[model samples]
Target chain A: METKMVISNLLHRPTRTIISILAVAIEVGLVMLTVGMTTGMLSETARRVEGIGADIIVQPPGASFLMGFTPAPMPIKIGDLLEEKVEHVAHVLPVLILMNVGVGVNIVFGINREQFDAVTGGFVFHSGGWFTGPDDIIVDDLYAKAGHLKVGQKLTLFSHSFRITGIVEHGKGARLFIPLQTDEELNQTQDKASIFFVKCTDPGYTDDAISGIRQFLPTYPVRSMAEYTSLYSSNNLPALNTFIEALICIALTIGFLVIFLSMYTTITERTREIGILKSLGASKSYIMSLILREAATICVLGIAAGEVGTLGARRVLQSSFPTLAVRLTPHWMVYAAVLAMGGTVLGAVYPALRAASLDPVDALAYE
Target chain B: MEPIILTSDLKKIYRIGKVEVPALRGVDLVVPEGEFVAVAGPSGCGKSTLLHVLGGLTAPTSGKVLVDGNDFSAMNDADRTRFRRHKIGFVFQRFNLLPTLTARNNIAIAQHIQGNGFNPHRFQAIVEMLGIQGKLNHRPYALSGGEQQRVAIARAVICEPKILLADEPTGNLDSENSQIVLNMLRGLNRSFRQTILMITHNPDAAALADRVLRMRDGRMLLD
Candidate 1:
């Protein structure tokens, strides 16, 4: 009966109820979508990097873990030195990475075809083949689909035109790949490489190879491929995590204020009804429960709506931008739901107490 | 029968920004168990004020109010509320049913508040006696004034309270509905021997009570 009363009260004011619900939904959706987008991009990039089949990665001293942010400061001879000196090193591919800010943010990799093929077990080409000329490039399927590009299509990068020679399967190191000599020539950085992808003769020799590389270049960043995905967490990027925290605070504020105003207005509107309840021997706790239960019901409904809305938004985003990944994991959904529920319930406390404190006589006499 | 309600020199003063306005002025009253008593007075003559005091809806400024062997004046706010829930039931002139709930839920809410849950047999008997069994599912807006009042009465008695306090229960009804509601009150009094105290200005409504008490200028007048 109490549940029925609470539901009926909410239904009685349909417009207010819907507005309140949508406000909570927007808060939850904002938190879920923003967090999902950032984490999704990170994990997706990490997975692709891992898919390169490299046993280990060696970057210059002080180089960022993010491949796109690292500069090509290491000499290309480091790859030759590692292959010649490090035991169990099958192949070492020296790669240059360029951060292209044109059109959109993208990472372009420069690699020698033979060395890259040997290190990564070769690319699975969906169409066409490896680079035919210095001015030609190979794009992953996701990038090609996103750009609506086909084999033989011309792609301009770094103010230089390159023909697309192949559309390869995704889940490699980078979306766009160009010849190493061409990249070094365009950037005027001959013999400079950003990182080295080291392939071990046997999977068990990864630790031995990394130790061997670390012996010569002690200050450089040497990471095993097995731990690559774990490096892409929010904790690894404080700025992104802070940005997510700020958004969560904003979402909390939105939920709190909406619930507060909604419950306050409902209490005021139902002052007489509250009085009637009091007159019928309803305790203070009962009245509080009534108001709190109503708010909680709204939050639960809003959370469900937000989940559905976020999934729909994800679909729209992925379809419109194929390369963009939006990962809606159950963990973050539960987190957002708990935060929304806490904030909404806290918002309802004042109004519930005020309603419970109302004098039955005055409330009954209220017009 | 011993008096179920007893008040001695009861007084209530309302202070609006320093000016003290007296609503109930040292009024003494009594009604025995199972008696149907009517309190008659013109508007602002403290009829509703007396009912509110007796119902524990408001505390008195000074005096002793005893209902169902419980001292209302001595009890704290929470204790008074608990006593009211177990012993006192109230009906208002406006037919103060929750507009959002169906008539059946409105009545069941009282039982829920009483912490006894619902009793289908008692609920059925009460609704059938009030002729609101068919209208149970309808919200208050769909019910007639007389029907709404009937629902309110059923709600007040659903917990089988020791005393029923009504402040003009039939005030808003038409003559036909008023007669039906008054007859229902009479039937409740006779069939269940329920103790009822009603406040009204209607002479016909007062005439239906076993005894009528008049009030003027916040004081009970001698019959």
Candidate 2:
């Protein structure tokens, strides 16, 4: 009976089609925003863990200073500071990675792996083996993504000219590593070690090691792997999360209300008819199911619309944030869709029950 | 044959704030299978009330209503509705065709609601027989008063219910359309052996029935 009425009503009025579309679109947009932000955070986190050049980052005092490009270059002497003072700081490989990147002064890190692994087991040279010799600079893929460099592309910085040998991606922050000898020669800092990475007997020693290093080097800073990643993430995001969350909440609230009211009015309009149906032998469940059938129809349409709206919204919003660390993964898409559909069902509960529980006698006589 | 419909000492009293207006008072009735019986009375009589009680659309305060030998009072509301769906048809004063549906679909839904599959040939025949061949696809709002009445009749008769209760079926129609609707009803009564219980104020419309039931003050004065 409900099936017949649902199909009949859909075909008859069909204006409800427009309403369903609009409702679903709003719902989907909300979900997309939520899942999109969630996804962005997840992707950025993954990227941060997937460090770029140095398998391990060596910085002064804190991760922020390393990520910040404002470093207090280590004192006394570059090689002597680590070689003479610290224990378990076995190999003191000195390399200059932090500097102003392009003509616009973007932060950058250049590595020299032969000198790098002499102290810490950090980054692996993925494609072209570690900067085995001088002038071999493996630039981070951001330069390519930023349309700054390609293979064989020459980047002339403050003191050195580099021919990009390979493009590399870092799991952690946005820094590049070249050969240490070349970096040191360019910076002309024979007496300076901006920072040093030390290999300990255990990964658990990381906290103690950082604390221990900070004690002797009072003015400097130190941080662990996770902390380092979080610093980059917090620095890059904050606003994206806050904006999307607010927009999604508002859209969902307004959309659900619209759908709820639309359904309510439909029930109100058909109150008398429902009574007639009840009189015609429809059970409470049967009547309820009949009305809920409309809700179901609306949900199906709404979910589809919301998904499309989300996609459209994502595309439109992408241009506003250039370094949007989120990847639009399919898993995130499915999650958003489920949210859109589930929200519609949740929103439909009150109206469906209200229409269902109506007394057939009263309903029939209702004007 | 046992009476298909039997009501024993049925009563309906509507309470308005403090006063109780008795609509039906211990009314006993028996309508046999395929019998054409007219219940006649002036306005306010219990003819309409009687029809509603017999059809199980309204429950009497006391007594028994049996349709096809089953006790209506004994069954629950759901069971009573099931009985109404399978055994009865109604044609209202306003010719209550659902305004949204086409004439054909309106008739078709009654059958579908009763779980009967569509038989186009039977539908086509019924529409043609009712002289609504040209207006099958027209909605109630699009059709004239007369045409809408015929469509209502078409819906009622198409289900081929055992008893058809028509409450002033031609009250809203003109004389010409009245004749058309009445003739179509009478044709259904004779050809299909339908048992019709129709109430009307129009003498001309009532005159067409095998029996005319006039109602007044919620009770029938004559039969």
Candidate 3:
């Protein structure tokens, strides 16, 4: 009977109920989508970096694990030193990475074709061969498809134009690649490399190569490729975690305020009905439970709607921006639902208490 | 029979800002078990206030009220509410059925609040007696004034409370509906020996009771 009353109350005012549900849905969607996009992009980028086939990476001291943020401060001779001096090092590639914010934020890697091919197994080119000229650029299939690019198309980066010489399969170090010498000259940092990619003679020799690199460049950041993906988590970026937390707080506030106002209005409108219940020998807890139950029902419905809405949003986002990855992990979905439920329940407590404490005589006399 | 309802110098004062307005002025009353008693007065003569006090809806200012051998004045808010849940039922003039619920649910809610599981037999008997069996599926808005009143009575008595406190149960009904509701109350009183205390200004309504008590200006007049 109590459940029936709650459902009837919600159905009695369709517009208010719908608006409340939408508010909660929006809150859940906001939290899920924002967190999903961040985690998805991080893992996607990490996977691509791992696909470069480097057994170990050596960056300049104080350099971030995100290669895009690292400057070309390390001398290019580090690659030759690791190759000649370090044991178990089969190949070493000196790469200069620059962050490009043209249509979107991306990293462009500069590589010597022969050394890059040796270190990274080799690029599986879908079309065109290798960089034909110093101004030629090799793009991955994803980047080419996103920009509607074909071989021989002219692309501009860092205010310099380059012809597309090849479209390779994705999952290399970066989406765009250029000649190492040209990148060094263009950036006016000749003989300097942002990082060194070391390929060990055997996959099991990764830890040995990392130790060898650490002996030579003790202050430099040498990370084994096996653990590279784990380093791309949100915990590695405090700023990103803070950003997600702030967004979640905003979503919680939205859910809280909407539920509060909705329940407050409902209590006011149903003052007489509350009195009627009291007259029928309802206890304070009974009245409180009724109000809270109504709010919970709305929240449960809103959560279901939000889950569906977020999935639809993910599909739309991925379709619109194929390069964009949105991962809706089961744990994050559960977390978001719990957060929304907690906020909405907290929002309803005040109104429920107010309803419960109402004087039966005054409530009955309330016009 | 010993008095099922008893009041000793019952007094209730309404505090409005700095002014203390007395609604019940030290009036003593008693009604024995299974009696149909009527409290009649003009508007604002403390009839509803007296009923509210008797029903444990409000506390008396400075007096003793014992209903069904429970001291209402001494009980705290929660205790009073519990006592009301187990021992008292109420019907108001407005036919205060929850607009959102069906007639059936409105009646069932009382049983739910009484903390007892539904008794289908009692429910059937109550609905049949009130002639609301066919109208149970309808919401309050779909029912006539008389039908809504009947539903309200069924909701009040579904738990078989020791006392039924009615405040102008037929005030919103026409003469035909009022007569029907009054006759139902009389039938309930005679058939089940239900103790009823009704408040009204209608002489005809008062005449249906076994005894009529009049009040003026918060003080009960001679019977």
Docking class of 1: high
Name model 1 segments beyond 4 Å from true.
Answer: none
Score every model by TM-score.
0.97, 0.71, 0.98
Q: Give fnat for candidates 1, 2 and onward, in order.
A: 0.93, 0.33, 0.91
Give the per-residue lDDT of model 3 (tens digit) for A1-367. 8888898899999999999999999999999999999999998998998999988888898888887788547989889999999999999999998888988798889999899989988999999979878999999988888889999999999889999999999999899999988888877888889988889999898888888889999998898886766899999999999999999999999999999999999999998889988887888989999999999988989998999999999998877776788989999999999999999899999999999999999999889
Q: What is the TM-score of chain B in candidate 2?
A: 0.92
* Candidate 3 residue-wise lDDT at A329: 98
Candidate 2 residues lying further than 4 Å off, grouped into runs, are A1-4, A11-17, A48-51, A57-172, A175-255, A275-280, A357-367, B15-21, B38-46
- Per-residue CA lDDT of model 2 for A1-367, tens digit only, reads 4565676766665787587667767666665666576667555644643433222235655434334344554542534554466554445454454566454334454444545545535554344445545766675554445555677767666656776676665442434566655655776655445655454445566666656666666665555556555554423567756766677677667666766777777788888766555544455666667666776777677777777676666666655443354355677567656655565666666777887677654565576
Question: In model 1 chain B, which range of ten residues has the least summed lDDT?
Answer: B214-223
User: lDDT by residue for model 1 over A1-367, one digit each (tens)?
Assistant: 7889888988999999999999889999999999999999999999999989998999998888998788547999989999999999999989998888876688999999899989898999999999879999999998999999999989999899999999999998999999999989987889989989999999898898889999989999898987756799889999999999999999999999999999999999889999999999898999999999999999999999998999999999898888898889999999999999999999999999999999998899888
How many backbone clashes are present in model 2?
50
The per-prediction CA RMSD against the true structure, in angstroms, equals 1.4, 7.4, 1.3
Please give, for residues B1-223, the per-residue lDDT of candidate 3 as tens digits.
5699999899999999999999999888998989999999899999999999999999889898999998888998888899889889999999999998899998998999998989999999999999998998899999999999999999889999999999999899999999999999999999999999999988999999999999999988965
